[model samples]
Target: MELADRVESLTPSTTLAITSKAKALKEDGHDVIGLGAGEPDFNTPEYILDAAKNAMDQGLTKYTPSGGLPELKDAIIDKFKRDQSLVFNRNEIIVTIGAKHALFTLFQVLLNRGDEVIVPVPYWVSYPEQIKLAEGQPVYVKGSEDNNFKITPEQLEESITDQTKAIIINSPSNPTGVLYTKDELEALGEIAIKHNLWIVSDEIYEKLIYGNDNHQSIAEISEELKNHTIIINGVSKSHSMTGWRIGYAAGNETIIKAMTNLASHSTSNPTSISQHAAIAAYTNSEEEIERMKEAFEERLNKLYDWMMEIPNLSCVKPQGAFYLFPNVSKIVNQSPFDSVDEWVKQLLEEEKVAIVPGSGFGSEDNVRLSYATSLDQLEEAAKRIKKFVEKYSV
Candidate 1:
């Protein structure tokens, strides 16, 4: 049987591959520590779950509008007002199965064949693949460890061309967990306005920030850029509702309506019950989110300190999100192993610890270790990694 050419060309998500491998090991009685998955270890908050139950009891099982339930869209509109001080009409919002799906729909709607998207290096594993699947070219702008894995406005300006259609800004970025500061975001926003490029801001980790600085969305900085910026956010990270499959994108009416039409013919709105759950997540402010943030912060600090003791392993303190992208080239390149892939493979096989190699995220000299696991697991995983590195020292 033949598959579609696009499906045939796409690679599976490396993060999911690592998670599946770890699960398979555990099923076979091996003790595996998985630090590859991106979701928080915390369970979906009780309030959100209760809302879903209430929805089911009230017969919310049937499908609603293609974009989203009106109530949920209103909740999202209200959320932007309360959280980011960014106002948008319900027509400007499109709710999808997840933030990932929202992004895919946006790409599919906006990109014609060969349209180039400026993707910063060390991006989320799925960004480039999703672009490729949509027949869009992902033009990567290299970011260095020296810059904390962020791209400068000058770098962004230099990458644009007539064919450049959009640029993805994933502040509080995945894998790296670096949050872009306000000034930095403004600079990039100015460039986007100058180039008339769409800005797809993935702010799913907005509430997961760990420092004194609050997470800022680009649209919040300027009224002119607000219409050009597509803000993608969800309750997945903030309320630990990953499985709820609810996310929304806010932007101009035309772009959002196009995405809504795409979703209508595709997934047809998000799950009815999940939308209800998301409504609760937005309306209610629980201390649980803060509690989870504290836990993640504690784990981040502990992992940073532990990694500091390990020779040749270095990581910048992540300001948000739950993963740490540490440069392990000192060990990977020096080792007899030929590549980062080989190093990661040997570590998983020998030490029963799973981490995603940076090659999957557009960097070959580092690996992403998710600290979303428990404190005990992080401690054990760090110990195993240290021992493995010591064994291979040059």
Candidate 2:
């Protein structure tokens, strides 16, 4: 059977591939420690679960507006106002199946064929694929590891061309948990405005930040920037509601209306019960959220230390998010392994540790190990990884 041309060019996700191998190993009765998950280890909070149950009991099972329920939109608006001090009206919001869907919808509405979107290296694996799926081109600018895997405004400016339509900024980024500061955002906002480009800010990991760092939305830099920015976020990471699939996009009314129209014909609406649960997620006290964050911070600190102890593996200390992106190039160079991908596969096969290789995230020198597992599992994974590197040391 012939597939569409769009499907032909799509690169399968390396994250999922490694994870599948890990699961297969476990099924074979091998005690595999998988560190490739991109979600909170914790289950959804009791309050949010109760909200969904109540909604179902009340027969809230019908379709909602393609955008979202008005109340859910209001809760999202309140969250922005309270958290980022940015305000939005209901017209500017569209709820989708997930943040990934929100991004997919944004690219579909904003891009024409041959349009270009600037994507930073070590990006969340989906960004480039989604842009391609929209028939848009993804022009990547590599971020320096010394800069904590963040691209500078100068690099962003250099990537822009006549066909450029938008740029993606995923702070507290996936794969690499680097957060952009207020100043960093202000500088990048200037570049976006100078080039008259849309800014797609994916803040899915906003609430997962650790220590003194805070998540700053690029939209909040100024009112004008806000107009140019579409904020994509969800309860999945923030409230440990990954399965709920409630995500939203907020931006210019016209673009949002267009996305909503597209969604109406596509998904029609996000799940009604999930929207209700999301409302509870946003409205309830953030005690459970804080508890989850604390656990991740603890895991990150210990696991990062353990990983550094492994010869030739060095990583940037992540400010937010749950993954540690360690540069394994030195070890890969010294060891018998020819590539980070090979090292990843061998480690999984021999030491029973599974981690996503960095080639999927556009950097061949690093590999992403998620600390979103239990402390015991993470500690064991680190030990196994260290042993594997030592065994292969040339």
Candidate 3:
């Protein structure tokens, strides 16, 4: 039997592929250092874990509302108001399995066949694929490295068409880790309002920013924009609760209801325990989140400095998130390797180092290195990378 056409048209996630390869090597006794997956190295905080246990003790294991638990929805509303100065009714918010699930549901609920979703390049790997799965086209707007890998308003406007329904904005972005400033969001927001297009803002990495940088949600730029924007976020990245699988969307009540209806039939409800755990995550885990951010910052600063010291690898120093995306084009040009993918392969085979190549992220010259691992692991990975590059740079 033939597979579904939609499934055939999709590409597998390169990030997961590299991560699985690393895991397989480790299983075979190879000392592989995996810097591919975006997960935080930290574990879920004890408080949140305890909350999950407390939920069970309280007999909350029964299925919650498919949209989410009312208590969890209330916490999300408070979170938006507390962090973004945005207000939402329970009708406008829905808890999802994770931010990835939230986005997947939104795309399905919003897009019609052939409708286009504008995606900024060097984006998170899932955005385009999800759009395609929804039978919508992905229109790319370049976030060139010169602009700190952020798209300009002019560029965004130029990509719109009669079929354009929405634009996906992520900051601090995955792969690039660059945070879009308030001014930038306002500019983009103006364009979205001009064209009446939805702005699907992915703020999953909002709480993980470094230094003086802060994440500005597009929906908060103006009242008009807020009406036209849907904010997607979750506890996975922020609270180190990746395994707990709790995420949410805040937007127009009609759209949220539609997404919730879809979830009702597909996945029923997010886990009852996860919803309660997320309540604790949003309401009580501020200190724990800050602590994880500090560890990531320390690792980022040292690893960034080391990567800069390497001769042929150039990268925009990421402002947030635990990943460092280095442009290894120069190294590739000097070496005999035909592409960054090939170079990554050689490094993995020779030094047992694994990194996601840029081609997977719509970029062919760069490689993303997540600093989520410990400093000791990061240091050894760096040493291995340097040795690998030096061998071919000559």
Error of 3 at 122 (Å): 0.4
What residue runs in model 3 are displaced by over 4 Å at the alpha carbon?
none
Query: What residue pairs clash in candidate 3, if any at all?
Result: 358-363
* lDDT of candidate model 1 versus the reference: 0.91
Q: What local lDDT does model 2 show for residue 171?
A: 92
Pairs of residues at least 3 apart in sequence or in different chains that clash in candidate 2: none
Looking at model 2, residue 232 earns an lDDT score of 96
Q: Which of 1 and 2 is the better model by TM-score? A: 2
Angstrom error at residue 248, model 3: 0.6
Measured against the true structure, the TM-scores of the candidates, in listed sequence, are 0.98, 0.99, 0.99
lDDT pick, better of 1 and 3: 3
The alpha-carbon deviation from the true structure for residue 382 of candidate 2, after best TM-score superposition, in angstroms, is: 0.8
Alpha carbon lDDT of residue 247, candidate 2? 95
Q: Relative to the unseen true structure, what is the C-alpha lDDT of residue 293 in candidate 2, on a scale of 0 to 100?
A: 93
Q: For model 1, give the RMSD to the true fold.
A: 1.0
Task: Name model 2 segments beyond 4 Å from true.
Answer: none
| Candidate rank order under lDDT | 2, 3, 1
